[model samples]
Target chain A: MNEIPQIELTGITRVYGKGEIAVRALDGIDLTVAAGEFIAIMGPSGSGKSTAMNVIGCLDSPTSGHYRFNGVEVGRLSQDQRALLRRHYLGFVFQGYNLLPRASALHNVELPLIYKGLGRAERHNAAHEALRKVGLDNRAHHDPSELSGGQQQRVAIARALVGSPQVMLADEPTGNLDTKRSIEIMEVLQDLNRSDGLTIVMVTHEEDMAEYAQRRIWMVDGRIERDERTRKAA
Target chain B: MLWETFRLAIQAIFRNAMRSFLTVLGIVIGVAAVISMVTVGQGSTQQVTADVEKLGTNVVMVLPGQDTMQGGPGGTADPMFTLRINDAVEDQIASVALSAPISQSRARVIFGNENRRTDIVGTDNRYFEAARWDLNRGRFFELSELQSGKAVCVIGETVRESLFGFADPVGETVRIKTLSCEVVGLLKSKGASTFGSDQDDFVILPIKTFHRRIAGNTDVSTLFVSVRDGASIERTMEEITALMRDLRRIGRGEEDDFEVVDMEQFATMLSGITDILTGLLSAVAAVSLLVGGIGIMNIMLVSVTERTREIGIRLAIGAQARQVLLQFLVEAIVLSLIGGLIGIALGLALAVLGANWLSIPFTPDPGIIMLAFGFSALVGVVFGFFPARRAARLDPIEALRHE
Candidate 1:
């Protein structure tokens, strides 16, 4: 499909602190992603992969950049406007599987829908569907503490997908899981991408985990050192 | 949205029920103290007002000295300074409705085998009208009996109860000292006064009979003067003062030897004093409320810190800063409101118990309860703000990295 890119970043430069003590997290980066591509960013510590994800998720603004989302200039938007963008178009799954510890799996999934202002019954159904997609519908009533690490990450993914965002930004979604649980999570993400054609941008240092993505970008010292398409879609 | 936020807040508060309760304990004690103190204070003030009303606001007592509230005569015990029955005989004053001379002495009365020490008052029937006392049964002393200085008396309900029990005391003769006095009437029951003294515990005798038989002299220690309903009490008091000064032949600049005490003014002063006491105590209790607010602030700060990761999760999931603020603010308010409700219940219970113990009426002021509730909610808002703001302003990236 020939459509406007889902994300575009031009001359993105993110600098922390100021003057003599300045540190640039992302130095003059330019990139674009189509509507249905799955991309992975791999880097070591201080390589700025997380910072790039933050910028893409609209959780943090870049120091100097032009960021466009679905052809709209996002860099000039206010903080609240960015939040609304995140609420409507971006879903985040952190490495810690940040489901509310006290909330049931169903309620945790319902969190994004609550911000989306969905009605109770409608949110409930959507959350159940999302949980079913992640193959954790049976664990909906269980709290995060009662669930396994894989189960908790699935719940977090269900929460992200409940809003049906335009893009999912998962920062090391399987970082805390064992290799077996990590492969299981990768399979879920791969199945969603294959069947639903969902756009995704994931960050991971594990090479095998990054191999699940259709395209891979390796970063070093705030610059992209390698970019390659490993394989075609299934 | 608001309902959902409240639900979330309630859930979070219930998650740590013990901590929430302990955090609100200060508010509970402060509110309870303020409510009970004000309630008990109001009850006593009302009792005092009722007691003074029974004395008849239109009535003014002319005592033979100054500062009689402390006790008897403040100056010299000169015979010339004492009130006489003749002083009450003057009907020349325009504001005077009724005037009766009263002289009282504590004496033991005996009827059959029963004998109890009680106050013996010497006054005519006009004292009943001036002092608002009504007879429960039998007749007052007739004019002929009063003129002849007959040894007749009217017994109070307490005296009748003590001396005659269930039998009628009228037509019976009660011995006071060596004098046998006929009981002509019985005063009605007035229950307990504001000071917890029995009002129906004195015996009344005709002043002439009292002077000739029991007192053995003509001396009236106090005078009860009732002013006309339409007359100003202050003006009447001034007139009485001038009359007494003229009667005593006092110089213009000299203070009158006698004090004219307005029953209404005394009642007002008593109530004023109680009001100040209630306010002072409530202010002290309010200090505790401030301390309670500080307690809430401290706890909320800790909660915010403890929930940093949770807040990060919420923000990452696209929760607005305002939404997070509202959640924490609602949690604090719910905690405070719970404390307020419990405090109200505890305070009312204490007020009821205090009233029963002190023998005063129990009066629950609804306005004060509403004020307490509103104040607690206000405390929640004021104290909950900073911590809530701190939570809202947190950077999601940094917060997520927090342990």
Candidate 2:
């Protein structure tokens, strides 16, 4: 890749609790993603792929070692700075379809804009633009309860993209969906990644879903077992 | 952001609808109870006090004892301690404007053929003005009748109505205690007083006649002294005590056997009971509010527990901890505010209704409503705090992991 890495994790480690009760979640992880790279992580149940993703997304801190997002060292950032980083650079999608159930799809998507302290009209216009890009503009006024599982996920994606972040971190995006719906979501994510050249790092276990990404990383017992790049563009 | 939280809070209450209504029901009832009880109690006490003051600023009926007598001490078993000195201290003492003596005795009044049992009040010319008695007929009896013990009297509206009906009772003769007396004057009607005593009852006569003919005594049973400018009641009382002690020839250590009372003194005595009632009612009302606060806390804790998953979802989707806290806190405050508003209306209504029942004008102090609403909102903040903080402090990972 000609561009410098957008996200880099070097010798990162995360452990929970202390001493006898302590459990390691991510052990000595070394990874790098160039600009516009799409990477997927896959593992068994005991693996800490989700923990690793949280660290990369700046949602959690690494116990040891450093994480750099867009060339800024995330490990050294303050809590407010981390929040600022999340606002300015990183977008997140969790497996639970984390749309606020009481909020309209437009409001849910506009949440990050609220944190950014954007004006009402600007945020509304931006949220509608993002929802339109997801092909669910008509459903923007509907609450999450009114939408199906797949459509809710689409609204979530719109929320993630609303702030126009440098990278999108999704943890098991299709984990709650059926096989047919899973492929449809994967197709949407793939189109966004290719068309906008948006860098995305996703965690999943389904082999077919992993095939949509250009690179894959496998984890075993909180450690990276393998890293492979399989589908480089010609 | 606060506005956003407010909107979501309203939405959250609507989510379960029934649960939210049930949760805030305690607060509503408690607020209404406090507002109504205090308002009505305050109104009644105020009405009673005003009525008492309206009786007369000049009248202080000493019923031959230390403890005050109901109505008048009409030949009661208590030892007589009547006026023994030149007790007309107002013209004598600088503090006093005027002084008068009254002795009450019950007797049947006979006018023509009709007869009615009534009280005979024996006093001087000053008694008419001091007791707020206005002449409705010719005039009060001449001052010579007071000194000569003449059989002259002034009748009240009730006595006039019962004995003479529409006839001019003035310039007519009536038999009291088997002694014939000329009615030289009639009194204008004053309404029933706070003690529920009939102010328009009985007859007034010269003190000399009351002593020699009706009551058969030269001593006065009660002395009422009106002060000029209506200030320094204590000074006037002190001088009266000193005057009584000196005139009675009692030793230095002996206590004076008289009481001088005014509106302020009466107000002081009555304020004790009213204050106690006011405090107790307010405390009971406050307890109800406290119970309401506890109810809010209980419901909010449950809400926090119920919305754990939802909280996790929001946290993952870029919602900050403050947003979560503000939402729940706003929900509680809104509930309380609505309850407070309803309570203010109910309280005012109860006060007016109570006033109407008692036949008194109702005036609600706006201060009470402000204080009540302020207290409720404060309760919401204090009680809703822990739950809101708990929601804010929740770990996203752990919350999402909950079943």
True contacts kept of each: 0.62, 0.25
Specify the highest-TM-score model's number.
Answer: 1
Per-residue C-alpha lDDT of model 1 across residues B252-358, encoded as one tens digit per residue = 78877778899888888988898999999999999998899899999999999999999988888888899899999998898888888888899999999999988
Candidate 2 residue-wise lDDT, A97-195, digit = tens: 877767799999998887777888999999999998888999999999999888999898999999998889989999999988898788888888999
Off by over 4 Å in 1: A231-234, B67-75, B80-90, B108-117, B135-186, B191-196, B208-214, B246-255
Please identify model 2 stretches exceeding 4 Å from their true place.
Answer: A76-79, A229-234, B13-61, B67-95, B103-125, B133-221, B230-258, B280-291, B326-377
The digit string of per-residue lDDT tens for model 1 on A20-92 reads 9999999987889988889999999899999999999999998998999998889877767877888999888
In candidate 1, the residue pairs with backbone N, CA or C atoms under 3 Å apart (3 or more residues apart, or in different chains) clash, namely: none
* Residue B328, candidate 1: C-alpha displacement in angstroms: 2.1
Q: Give the winner by lDDT.
A: 1
Candidate 2: which pairs clash?
B90-B96
